[model samples]
Target: MTKTEQFSKLLREMEECGEDEQKQKIEEMKELINEMNTDDFRHVFTKEQFNKFEKMIEEKKISLENAALLLKHVGYCKKLKNIWIDGLKESLLNKRLELIIIAEDEKKKDEKNENLLIDLCECYISLSRGFPPELLSICVPHLLKKALMKGKNEEIQKEVEIVLLALSNIDHYGVNQALYLDEIKEIIQHHQEHHNLTQLAYQSAWLFLSYRLFFNDKSFKEVVANELHFVREAKRELVELTRQVDWMKKEENRGKKEEKELYIFFGWFSSIGNFLINCDLWNEEFAGLICSITRLLRVAKDNYRDIRRWFISILKTAAQKGAAKVDDLLKGGAVEAVLEEILQPAIDGMTEEDCFIFFLNISERLNEKEEDEKEEEERKAAKMEIFEKLEKEGYEDAIFSFHEKLPKAVFHPSFMFVPKNLSDYLMHL
Candidate 1:
């Protein structure tokens, strides 16, 4: 038999060997391939044959325990590492080996092995292209949530975070749909009662928001609302707890600090605000929620200036976008009052040049309120000039002319200057 035939024979025989016999056969095949003159071996085996042999070897090693053993006398695990590192192409068929290495705690005991597991997870995630949506939908979230729930050690936690970040990058609704509300609820519940994962709590809340928004399923909105309520309650509980903590009280007395946990509620409230605002849906509870958020911002201002500003910005944006829903809040004039307070700090905090630019923006916004026709005409003229300039620069038919298309209304000088012919005006477009 030719060398190619011999490789094929070994692969065929591999199925009959016991785990040890299979390893021996694999080693024998490797030795035959290694010992042969490189040029002659290359000349004998076609590229396709070589690829098939490599794929077979990779599958055989990865499935060692699953397949019935052919030869009972040879060692398999000894050859497994070399086959993994050297024999197989880093293809999807060989990806299972990575899962095997990372499956058990013992295999991952060594730091280097742990690192390798992380690297392989990352590599598989990165290189997995042409992966069908159905598979990705089932697989990615399963792996991510599994890692997050199961990974307790610091190293494993870090690895799990990396996997989640990778999953987040896929940017598809199907990916988010794969996760159930129950899973998210469990995570939130555990984090809330345990106090062990407050940081993760915040991260997961934002991630859940992203998941819901991108998925755009209304059913999840109620779930989001419930999550928001839980988070809000947690925040209140934290603040009350902090007030009781001795060190926190001492710092408060010295005017040296305030409770940091207060901002957790702020974060949660902002997300809740978004959910309420976007659906154009509101209830008495939501109204009270915003009011409480506004009060919280006012209280947290001295200690957390940045967060205070951010909360106010969220309110302003909501009032602007959800104008009808926010009419009551605007009537309360919380935004206008807060803006006045923010104005000086926002301006005073800026460099001279930035302040000047900011002042100009303020002037523009202030100017927008005046319903002066002259200013409007001037702005229109300026806009027309810009449009004309753009049109002249080869933007064909960039501007449509209402006047040109419509017939001119004749002034009969009899009654008002209104057109006698109605169709003339109607054809303006």
Candidate 2:
């Protein structure tokens, strides 16, 4: 039977039984689920059906609604909401019910509920030990300070990791909407006090800078500008730690973990390049930051392409935003040398789709510049004018034939090269 049908059958069996029989049915269903070879469909239940099951589990009913809820909850259920609070009182709670609802709090960002789905899965760390475990080992005091400043749930390490990962992934605009400055500032302050947390502080500071640029806010420019020292410090630390990979593994030193070091390095370096360009701090520092980016790309051994893409993006963004400052970087031949030497090689090595995406990045930068120069109202009028002209030529021609010619002059200079074909086509039209 299908997973849902099996689940429905089990729910019917469980509900029809006495207390003793219910245990037997539950055991039998567990065995059945374990035995099922569902390699093609990893989920035992789909998301919608799982939610149905979650609601039914609470009501202890045997209906379509209950079976449906069971399916949804079982499919998507990662953690139970506020289960940590309950674990404090009842130590013998069922492991399955201990699931926390990983749904993003709509009130957290004042956005629509559907706009933010369950962004991450957080396995509950029991709170019965009196208070939430110290996250300092995983997250620095500065990170804790900032994550909690908005009264977010930093008590859970997985949740904090999710937020940090989110901060890294989301666009500048999204981060601004999601995170508060008060939280960011507090986190930076926390990092300032911690000696071993220089990397953490830099990443937080960099993210803050990125968030600022995304929103076009100048207030955090000073904070980002002042962080060049920390960026350098963090980079140095990363190099030192990575160099001692063997020693760290032998000593089992957690501080020298490769993943942590690479991310911290990336977080700070990308931030520095982004901040310098955004804050308009154009000079040797900006040049040095770009060079640092190039260096990272050279030494890149990480499996994650996102990290590499961001590194290149920082260069493109710096060039786009710091257009004024780039005259000097270009004059020294660094710009041409890097692109021809570094970026092109990377592009050539990438998959066809990746090459297309890289081209799109360049195209977007050019398009965005053009877009900024045009008046929004004028563009709308131009669009309407094109439609009107097309209507005069007949709506079908406008839609299929005339629209294709709009960008032919600019996009295809080769149109001039094919003079005979163009003449014949134009004559036919």
Candidate 3:
């Protein structure tokens, strides 16, 4: 018989063999492939035999060891390599090889065979691309462990990040049902403490949180709010990122290249704010988080314009919730920041529009504030304080400035002028 026919017959026999005999036949095949010339070995196995091998592996009739041996011998044949990788993935998806077992196997071979670890990680990533729910239970811990492993080679660390990102792409259902919340939080904390990995870590954390918010899962939300204290951690990260931006700016003044770190921080901060607003967990702590952001605003020199705009957008959303949230924004220094931004001579028109909208919302909340007999005096005093601050900050002048810039006969003709009365003017606008 020809080499191809002989290999085909052997494949049929292997399929019919019991486990022990199958192992022996696999060993025999491996030895045969090892002894054959590379060109001859490529010719010996027909496409049908390769397909049968893949099926056997996926069916759990072949051991991972034998699968790896098959992949190793496939070498640089792109078609065979792809087929082997698909078989490995099929095995994983079919649960023929449990994730923990794969992880353990990867750990054992990590030091001696780094390439295998990468290949395995790639398989996990492929599964994650489908946003498979199984990934949360099976793949996450292993990926996090690999990411957090001490003394991991740089290549391994990079592969771990790629896998983490792939896992982060899991859709809302996958995130809501995810079983490794604490472990994910640990990964976030680990990277938060590491100067270089903070961005990647935060990116991963945001990915998970965004999906949770999308699904509106209360239990998972509580995990982030109470256990992870996501707002607090995000605040800490923002502080670090702000300082880094300042350092970068100074370096630029000294003739170094300008860095885009500030933009990156802004993107993350905006994402956090947007996610938090949708979570419906706004409370005193959430207010305090906004207050902390205002404090950051005070210290920010570069990119303050964009920062103020994005932050005020968040404040506006918070204010719309109720009087209490508006009070939170006022107490958080949001009013002062809005006034400051509105008063800027060169502020963009869109930004001024946003600030004006926020001002109107806050004013409406203040008007609707209930008068409790016991707290009447305190409430009046607080309102008086806010009024005084607005007046002192040129609230009228800012309004006039904005009014003067409006086009004549616009679609919203009411917006063309600032009314004489503050409340009436806001109501009209």
Candidate 4:
């Protein structure tokens, strides 16, 4: 018999049982649920039956509604593991969609049976927990769309929260931003001012929204800028990052879970920095962003070079792309954040290449000859202050190491044969 058919048979056996024997039948059913949970299908099915099960999923012959009714009995879904999940890759993706269809069908029935619908959603959670990141494509839009639709109904908000958790699994394997950016953005916009939506729900939608921003696709830059109204969202996320960074910096909060979450957010936040630079979307309204992000450098351990690289990229973009003025950046403690906090902590190798590039941008701005005599003197003082700090700190060593190459980098003739390494040095510096 098929898994569901076997389950169906067990249900029949339970129905036919006398009241005195009901408990025994129920134990048998629990055994079946365990029987269905296995490292390989063979644990539950004969080899021939297992191959047929795979074929049914691939051929669209499985009834997911009934499948959910079966899997829900296995109970709570947490972060599932690897191994068999990957082994079942091809059909497993189809199986996941089948489960979604069942969940949506249950929602449509709206039978007012909260428990039943919730149990069905658990089936999705159990399966989705082990899903590979790339396989997220087919299910995320549906989940977000369901959350957006169901969030409007206050009575069903609990179920909607559970749905959001399913989407939040993107933390394990991030979604491909290009695939569902628009839909995710719409969900975020919907949640921003929603009345009955819980804070948890709203935050989850924004989380949904951020996964889409965590990638580089030249095509989506304009979409992010225009459609997503990214500037507003960028400031909003900065506020959140400020809170999170502050909370994360506390010594008491240094538990393993917090550390794991911190690194995960760092990876996503790193990509956000990339968007700021690659999208060319920076402007003056983002001045406070530098302050908030620079503060995050305080907690970013210097040995984590790539995260530091991404954070510096944001500062570099802010300095170069006009979102933040050089004077404002200097005044906002950017100089100290870059030099003492990030560079000095990084004792092993050169993490300050971008720092120099950032300083070069600042130097050029400070070099601009002021029309006012008093302003000229103030500008010279700022320049001198930065130069002194760089020398006092070891950034001067980086500068002195660049030596003649620094001049050529600053004033490379367009026609000169800038070697690949030289081009890379200038790019990084």
The positional error of residue 173 in candidate 1, measured at the CA in angstroms, is 5.5
| Candidate 2 residue-wise lDDT, 177-249, digit = tens | 2334556555555545543233443454445446456456544554545543433444455455445433223
Encode model 4's per-residue lDDT on 112-175: one tens digit a residue. 4444444444555444346554345545655655665644666677556656645554543556
Clash tally, candidates in order: 8, 22, 0, 2
lDDT of 1: 0.42
- TM-scores, in order shown? 0.39, 0.41, 0.56, 0.50
Candidate 1 regions off by >4 Å? 1-139, 147-176, 190-196, 226-277, 299-305, 320-324, 327-333, 336-339, 342-429
For model 3, state the Cα shift of residue 264 in Å: 4.4
RMSD of each: 19.5, 15.9, 13.5, 10.1
**How far does residue 102 in candidate 4 sit from its true spot (Å)?**
12
Candidate 3: TM-score? 0.56
**Which ranges of candidate 3 are over 4 A from the true structure?**
1-174, 189-199, 247-260, 282-288, 298-305, 322-324, 370-381, 400-429
Q: Best to worst by TM-score, what's the order?
A: 3, 4, 2, 1
- Write candidate 3's Cα lDDT for 284-352 as tens digits: 465566777777666652445556566666666565643235556767788787777776677776666
Question: lDDT of each model, Cα atoms only?
Answer: 0.42, 0.39, 0.55, 0.52
lDDT rank, highest first?
3, 4, 1, 2
lDDT of candidate 3 at residue 429, scale 0 to 100: 22
Q: What tens digits encode model 1's per-residue C-alpha lDDT throughout 141-200?
A: 454464456435676554444444334324334544545456656555555665433342
- lDDT for 119 in candidate 3 is 44
Of 2 and 4, the candidate ranking higher by lDDT: 4
